[model samples]
Target: MANIFALITGLIFGFGLALSGMTHPEKVLGFLDVAGQWDTSLLFVLCGAVGVTVVSFRFITKLKAPVFAPIFRLPESNAIDKPLLIGSALFGTGWGISGYCPGPAVALLASPNWELWVFLPAMLLGYVLHWYLFKPQAQKSAAAAPENTKAEPPTCG
Candidate 1:
């Protein structure tokens, strides 16, 4: 049942990405380009997304549990640490250079362009490498860490 909802949502999201011109590399790149040929069209898309999320999340938080899930599985961490900073830098750098984040990249794959071929493989490789290198150590550290070290609950504004 969850998988069905997931597929439906994914299809809707992909269709939205396509309709919004997010699947086009040039459109995404143009949005990122600060000095030349900067396209403000995607700004509307961003604003619409933020607007919907801001309105919807207000109602979403009022629900006792998610419709599709028993519990809300959210990230526990609120700390702005070195790993977070580094990961953000890496992600931003990649987005600026390639002009396609993972979501758009996957949506763009319907056309199967050469750029998507390169970017998708590299992206998957990065994920695999991160898991291979860090997952074990992360698990070990979590296991060794004191049980009393609870992360602070996030404060809503």
Candidate 2:
């Protein structure tokens, strides 16, 4: 049931990406490029997304748990740390260079692009590197740390 929901959600998301012109690397790159010919359409798309999330999360969080999941999953990190800063820098740099993020990159596989030849390989390399190099250390650190450390217990209102 959850898998079915995920499948439907992914399909809808991919369709939305395709409809929004986000599947095109050129379009994404254009939005990032400041000095060159700029495309502001994606800004509206991003703004719309932010707006939706801002509104939806407020209401949705009122629910005790997620509709399709056993637990209420959400990001607990709010502080800017060294890892966060560095990772964000790397992500931004790669996105600026290739105009490809993971979601759109996967969607790109549905279409054909020369950049995907470069993007997909590099993306996979990053994933492999993270899994092989960082994941074990991360897991050990997580295991060593106390549980429920990332977030505090919710207060009774």
For each candidate in the order shown, give its overall lDDT on alpha carbons. Answer: 0.83, 0.81
C-alpha TM-score for every candidate:
0.86, 0.85
Off by over 4 Å in 2: 145-157
Task: Supply candidate 2's per-residue lDDT for 111.
Answer: 85
lDDT (Cα, tens digit) per residue for candidate 2, span 1-157? 8999999989999998888888887899999987899898999888877889899989998988887777776666676899788988999998888787888888878886787888798899997887688776667766777986423332210
Distance from true location, Cα of 93 in model 2, Å: 0.8
Against the true structure, whose lDDT is highest?
Answer: 1
The 10-residue segment with the lowest total lDDT in model 2: 148-157
RMSD of 2: 5.2
How big is the RMSD of model 1? 4.7
Q: For candidate 1, give the lDDT.
A: 0.83
